[model samples]
Target: MTEPSSTPHATAPGASASSQTAASQSAADETPASQADFRASARRTFAIEEAAIAALESHLDDDFDRACQLMLATKGRVIVTGMGKSGHVASKIAATLASTGTPAFFVHPGEASHGDLGMITPADVVLALSNSGETAEVTALLPLLKRMGTPLVSMTGKPGSTLARDAEAHLDTSVAQEACPLNLAPTASTTAALVMGDALAVALLEARGFTAEEFALSHPGGSLGRRLLLRVQDVMHHGDALPRVALGSPLRDALLEITRQGMGFTCVIDDDDHLVGVYTDGDLRRTLDQHGDLRALKVDDVMTRGGKTVRASMLAAEAVRIMEENRISVLVVCDEDEHPIGAIHMHGLLASGVI
Candidate 1:
């Protein structure tokens, strides 16, 4: 999980600490009759920003389609480059692209000028981000990037700026004005850029028909990957570690097997090694309530017949779901003939990061 850090500079109206200062200043600068003026100013900024983003919906034209096609055809990763705040958004965009299907990585424009440009190659596509379309570090590398025959896709606010004009395709992320009360900081423009990046990534992801399993491949270190990739067989107890009792075994012997395996249940199989039934703690409790001698009864008489089972190849997440739907804690893994192969408990799912 990301560390919980306060949004020191976030412009979220009443949700960010920075807005407190803006609110206090607004209160002091306005009179009773000028309340409407303050509201009108703030409302206008929001309206302008909204209109700017609305404009982008129509601007997602053939250029956007060409950019997606270029990215999909790449034999190498997409190298996202930008300066300042655009660099932060660029890093997130790269991560989103990588997780969705298009492999990508971020290379800071300043770092590129210093020596990191070696990360780019002829097979790679360079995605340059600049709100004003005039960032110095970004513009300086355009000629060199173009010379290498690397296709350029620029996301910028100004369509006529050098970065946009020089790119093979440009995505417009322009905003009418900043959401900043001073109308100077990057607020609306940054949000617009971030949204555009998400739109592009998701569009490509859909076009590629990216699956959840494919997304998990790119995030093998995370919990989602563990849930999707880990199978029931990988976390199940096997051999003597499983609690099992032959048919006609005494209930006491079945209870002993459960205690020995520490799985809270025992499988009862016939002479042929096919599952006959299962004896859980709940079954034991109900059996004991019948006033019969615990040691006198056989597992075949007390076990729950044809209990719930799962296949060894099923995903751990699916196993968790099946267990949940049945209100059970463990499932018997079975083979084609309904013979017990392995057993898994809820705790095993948690241990395997499938919870």
Candidate 2:
């Protein structure tokens, strides 16, 4: 019987992901502007949006400070509301604020006019985004907001418009022109609004002195959370799974321990159960190169004396740094007395998303 060789096909291992992606992209491009230089058009859009965001610096005034102070002093949540494209940017801003220490959530202007207006309170602060500052759905909520005595902070292109005039503070997010050729789409205007929203959230974050650990608490399930919160002991192999052998043990015993634990290395411990050194696969190769008498070799002679170690309480990210700086793939987790309680390998760090 003969095993067939894999041929170069779209789904085969021989066809790499890059090749598949290129094929799909070329096949799926059905643009009407195929004759136009797409990359050059993209560059122009970037330039226009960049100018819009940069223009905001000149527009900053006491209104920006008033907006920040209003949100900071609010006892209840920051209620973010918008319509159409502005709604999408408002949703993201609310999420950023909530995660960064300022509690906030988004409410659609149309929905707010319905029954969701009941969700707002006198202690709450309302952040409204409308490029025209006169969006019917948004402006409809202004009278109710004033009646309830809820402070309004607005980001609008038109400073003289109704929404801006009603707000306690107005952030001018006006842009010179739309990046769209038709000059109707909310291209540069939306970018300016989003950047202004981020400025507000980050300003609030610094005012609150938000810490990374607190940020991790808000995002407890992602790779970022693991990087910020996971300790060396949480990811290291411990107890019986920890690979180790006596310091004076024969090199073959260290080899057996490494193979049994599948850690590619083994800790060498003295009779008092304290780690004295470590023997790795690299050490094995070096030992074989330097010593012809394999039978006479001991772990004590071949091992790296007092090999690099980390405390169990150390951060997993710090452990990764040590591994990178030392050019090693593994580290022994030692106690105050330098006794090996556990071990960590590069594979474990990668698997735990701490790498």
The candidate that wins on lDDT is 2
What would the per-residue lDDT of candidate 1 be over residues 60-122, giving only the tens digit for each residue?
A: 878898899899999998999888999999999999998999999999898888899999999
Model 2 Cα shift for residue 318 (angstroms) = 0.9
lDDT string, candidate 2, 54-125, tens digits: 999999999999999999999999999999999999999999999999999999999988799999999999
The 10-residue segment of model 1 with minimum total lDDT is 8-17
lDDT of 1: 0.90
Model 2: residues with Cα > 4 Å off, grouped in runs: 1-40
* Whole-model lDDT per candidate: 0.90, 0.94
